[model samples]
Target: MTITPQNADDSCLINQTVPTGVMSPPSEYLDEKKQLPNQNQNQNQNSTSHSGEDQESQKGRSRSIEDATAPLPSSSSSDRGDDNDNNDDDDDFPEGGLAAWLVVFGSFCSMVCLYGLINSVAVFESYFSTHQLAGYSSSTIGWVFSVYLFIVFFFGVQVGPIFDRHGPRLLVAVGSLLVVASQLILGLCEEYYQILLTYAVLGGIGGALLNVPAYGVIAHFFKRRRGMAVGVAATAGSVGGIVFPLFLQAVIPKLGFAWSTRIIGFILLFLSVIANLLVRSRLPPSTHPVRILPDWTLFKDLKFTLCCVGVWFMEWGIFTPLTYIVSYAAAHGQDANAAYTLLSILNAGSFFGRFLPGFLADRFGRFNVITITNALCVVTILAFWLPAGDSRALLIVFAVTFGFASGSNLGLYPVCIGQLCDARDYGRVYSTAVMIGSFGTLTALPIAGALLEIGSDERQGWLALILFAALSYAIATSCFLGARVLAVSWRVKEVY
Candidate 1:
């Protein structure tokens, strides 16, 4: 007999026919008593029971087969629902697209304006100490930049939560205005306090506003590719680092400090416009009002605590070289032009170093790559920088190598922090980490400058400072290793 199965959708046709031979006896009918010879009776009863059991088992199997092959209304619908839910979750992350990359580009421009000015601090420091603040000791002059650096990170504590609530638009816009204003007004300042208020206080606040959001917004757009995205954005700072110094070197001789700064202000104005247009947040703002305060409770996480400590020491080591490299080169008898050129070279190397480690961190692990680079920084400080007294080539080599190694610290530290917390809390966590590290930045230059005064000879003073930097990196490396070990076991092959 031929039979046609019903489709699941055709539920209206409820009645169906079965072939005549397909029906089975009821259990009671099959079990009814039978008479026979004693031995034959036993065998016949066993065969009857076995036949009934076989038919029952076959029927159960056929039902299971039909259930497996045919789709049920509720189950099939629910399955589709689950798939849709998963798709919705995935759709929340754009991952990679034109809009996403535009955010990245906008971040890049913002960083160029923010960090570019930051990276060029050495130029300002060098120029100011010699010209405007010539009467002050190097240690005293260090306070201006130190204060600037301190406020930049310290303000992040408050700015981070604000970014989470309002998004990056207003923060970046205000930052752009403040930074441009700082530069434009900076050219007109002559007194120490005027310079301090204009450059240190104003610029620092602007930078804090710009810096946190530039790094934080990228977290909104990318996850797996975050390191690469951050790296690309960070390279803009190094480019600014290279360009700003060269720009100053070229124009300062002809236009003097005032007009040179104004030209830079104009350049920053243009960059800020691009940043305002493109930099945007992908995630929605928090519904509940968040306190614009640092969550000190984050210290509860040992990894975060350790990461903060590691960053503290790393920041202590990093800025000492950046702030003092030009001064150190000049003190060691290098020509004025060459001494300033060393800063450019360091930033030039940093241009590549910023992105390369970022790219590598995505493939390897963030902590792993940062730890290696931090170790290299220690080696460069002690091995190359310390012994290179008056050696132009060694100073150049140290600048380049140290720049390459230390550049990762800026780009990778945020990525490392992101690894510890949710993306939504990244701004708060990262800003807190930076706030902690700000103390290091605040004290490192002044302390290094004081150490410079301690030595009777300039060489001895520099040696003390270099050793201080080296020791800081050593501590940073240890903390990073501890954090890594806590995150993943000692197994070297683990991808963590």
Candidate 2:
């Protein structure tokens, strides 16, 4: 009846019964002792020996059921200490280094290509209205850019999940080809349908493919300093915004729209190559297939839902100015070159706005900075832009001020969303939010264009459009404030 530790695993032990006279302690008591250092070895040895007539009976009973049931002792604390060290190593991040910054540089290049074009939509709008597509209504021309913006964001719903499963290389490389091809083909389009098919559909799809991974890759190398890193990359778009308008203005006169677009296409080809080389995902791919799909259940989170709503409104108002400022300026009496300069000036202010708020968002709080900027967007539109009319100085001020205020809208949305979930799920969450926001971008511009068709004069129509944009910002600011309050209480000092 006596059981030894060496015989513990034997099948014979399973049916053995202890004697009735000797009682065994409960399993829980022995389980607790098993957690202590090497004590189970002594307890086992002691239980093996018994004296007197009861020796045989006691021996039978000492075949401890608790010892049989308990798990084997864990490895020494020194071994566990090594395990802890290994875990710490796994969590370590390369916050800033040459490789990390190179990734940032790659993202910057990609943004310049994607966002630069997005910001320069006004230049194209102005040009098409006055030249090639002059017979088309403004609302009709508006669809080309609106569709482009729509595809750029809406397509991310699929591209994001693919990036999560496959990584960024192929997506970006393919995107580079499509974007460069779009630009090259864009110069050849003489008809309205040709322009829409070439620029809006093809260019938009390319931008979507390039844009998601560009921003997504930054999150991989940065966590603590992500705001600044993302900010730096986002500035490339504004720089592109500034440079493209000026480039188009100068080249369209000299080389004509066709060759000018081809030149820009060549520049984009070079930038896309850099993006394909530099922008890479640091994290391992998700093994779960479900992870690669949009989880609509995430919208159930009230804070996230509110954040998306806020972004939707922000996007609704944002592109209205970017798309119309040149037209607005020209309509109000500014000459062609001056109107294009105004677009560049807006982007110039945005170049600073993109990075500075990002630098501060890391310290002050992403939502805090975003909320403040959103409020400022409302103020600038209502106060500065709406009343400017033909006043050249006032229009310039509005362009710069509104540019600075709204620049954070694009840069900070991803940063703010990153705060709400695990880094691995960032692609899904971010793309889903943007997909929803794309509706606003798709509708906002055309609506503004239609609004421009209203009223006795261009100024009256523009005033209505400006008021609409201001109202959208006001709602966006309120939603962001609500999200901020839901995430972190009204405690004035919290750094969330």
Candidate 3:
């Protein structure tokens, strides 16, 4: 029977056939006239008319049933056309513009609030576990901060897709509200579970929501410059890390944790507002009804997969030092006041760590910068931190140097992953890494706590932490090298 398939495009069809049809020569008689453009059009129409008869003749004569059940001409043609249309759509994007850069700046500010405080949580944890919450076990108190961090990255599986579907305005707005609430309630959290539920889980969710949008919005506006833009934006988190610790150090003693945390929350609220105003996707929401779920298929990308593994190891051990350094100092030998100052010094080094290496990554390669810096971190822990006695000068050197190296690790991971995937898939890739890294944060501190317990002394615990940092960095270095091998082969001289 004759069939006319769906015609979705306005262009004249170039080819056609019936489902059962055998291939045929042009029906127009072979003549000089056939070469004319006008004759070609006439031949196309005549071929359409003969389609059914051609199908029947071919079906009965052909030996293969597969030939008889072949696809229809219009269906095949339309499929090709549709594929082209999708490609065209995928190719369309705004790589960079004034408004897009502004959005990047806005994203930077949002990250400062969401991730900045998070980076400084060690300072908070060290101080609180010793002072106000000194009654709580280190492991128990750790749970409070772990849950906070866990939520920040864990819930992005849903939040990311939601941002893709609805844009950042409402998502960021809600995050702002939740984050502010977290800070307000945090002031009242005297019990362990209250802190866990309020700061760890609730604040984490808020930060997670804020984070995906913070990075995802920039992806919408850039492709070629995505690395630089995201690196610059991400540096704000470190800036926040730097600023908040110093800010808190000054205020917490004077104003107290409740008022200090509230002030930081207010700062976050202001940044989130700016983020809501600026962060935007250039394209409309995708028409396909799909949930934004973390696809493990990302592992198929060898470089990306290795990078994720490296990040996991880096995060797991990175926090051990971050959370324990102040406490370690205070408990072991240094004055409490001096110990707190160490956090500020670490963050100060981190400020340049996050920014300068990012600029360097653009010139070198993301993996190259990450591996070298991470290796430096491993060495510093082994060489400097291990032998650090009550010599305040040595500890200061270790903190600043390790802080700088660790800063490079933070700034480069996302940029490296962004290199691996299409701009649109960045949120999924980023969140997946964050999701996996969350577990690292959840366990690193507790493990240090347990090690401290093993020795019945804070000094032994500090030794375990130094060991953890050294080993974790060693693992990270391996993973990064593995990724480097995959990307540029064994060419050790390659910049990537």
Candidate 4:
């Protein structure tokens, strides 16, 4: 008698499709079912008293499933401990504690190195266009960041399983080494190919390794408050985004591109050390087999599948503004400081955007909060950004509001996926969805760049990108609404 992910027998998983991806105990995994009293323990013990070894094993297995949320019993526990223990801490997430907070801090530091750079990619795009790869077209230069983002998310499918099996230590260590090297080498890169290798390939892979575990470790520490915990850690991205651009502005002129990048590498080196020391998981290693290949069958659940599509569209829309805002402001005849300031303003709004919505999501429901944020994203892009031209006031307003609306996208998407899957499967399920969304990240900025190229003039090209961004968000909003309606069956008041 054995249990594996392949043989999940929960009534919710096998008997029929869970419409909301939720149900009562023994049949579903939800926040409400984290702890339960085992009503059948006495009957199971009595029935197995004189039973043969196989019967005893079978009895233990039954008790394990029926009382899955209860503490693991002494008899035959090891045989199926992985399945039970995986959910053991679903209810046990320390709402607040020193060690848990330390892990959050460590994740924050990791994100500063990972997403922090991601948020500042526009600076690199601007610099490379004017400096090292000046000969390349904007579309060609756009490939660098697009490929970088693609690697970070696409390799997430592999990183998630490895984190589940082995934890984050080795992954973070190797990732740190690679990321540090990429930054150091990037300072020396002048050719298109060298920049591609160092920034896109090397940096991207390192980012993937660090990003998943940084998030997975947080998932290990907090469940009920995961949205907020993740949101807080995610603030490091905005913080980094703000810090790096300003740092680059000051240092790039003084130290030149080479020394500025090198200094950033040193900063990442310092942060990585802190992250490695503090980040560790409380949960025991998962015994279920790791599947590097995605489980495509999960998409059969239409709600979950649509959620993935929604994220795919989200990246396409959100990244365009992030990468182009600096250039857009510059095109309006702003100085260097003014241009970078707008990007900083966006990141500043994102700082509040992550934790505030996360706090709201915990009380309001992840799906509900994210849908509102996405709608806000559509409005800000269309109403504020599309028409904001040379007017500094309008551009500043657009940057702040759009950044707020899209800030929750990163933190809450994982929270939404968590609501749809078993606690134990969060990492894998989330990474798979990200992998599918990687295609959008891979092409988004490049396509926007190409659109910029197509216009008769630079302003016309940017106008086209603005329209594309709004349309992408509009489509994404509809997909998310469809998923929510399917999950809650038109009950808009339902907390999801």
Model 3 collision count: 3
Off by over 4 Å in 1: 1-91
Q: Quote each prediction's TM-score.
A: 0.82, 0.82, 0.79, 0.84
Compared with the true structure, the alpha-carbon lDDT of candidate 4 equals 0.79
For each candidate, the alpha-carbon lDDT, in order, equals 0.78, 0.78, 0.69, 0.79
lDDT per residue for candidate 4 within 1-496, as digits (tens), equals 2222211111113223323433344434333332455555666566445444444233202222233334422232323232343333334467669999999999999999998999998899888888898888988999999999999999999988788788889999999988989999898888999999999999999999998888888877776677888899999999999999999988888889888889999999999999999998766565447887987877887877888999999999999999988888877888878888788889999999998999777656677789989999989988898888888999989989998999999988887876665545556777888999999999998899999988578778988999999888888888888876765556555554
How do the residues 56-88 of candidate 3 rate in per-residue lDDT, one tens digit apiece? 332211112233233223222222222222111
lDDT of 3: 0.69
Which residue pairs collide, candidate 1?
none
Candidate 4: 10-residue stretch with minimal lDDT? 3-12
Cα RMSD, each candidate: 18.2, 15.7, 13.2, 8.5
Model 1: worst 10 consecutive residues (lDDT sum): 6-15
Question: Could you tell me the TM-score of candidate 2?
Answer: 0.82
Clashes per model (N, Cα, C within 3 A): 0, 0, 3, 0
Instruction: List ranges where model 2 is wrong by over 4 Å.
Output: 1-91, 290-293
Off by over 4 Å in 4: 1-90
List the pairs of residues colliding in candidate 3. 147-200, 148-200, 152-204
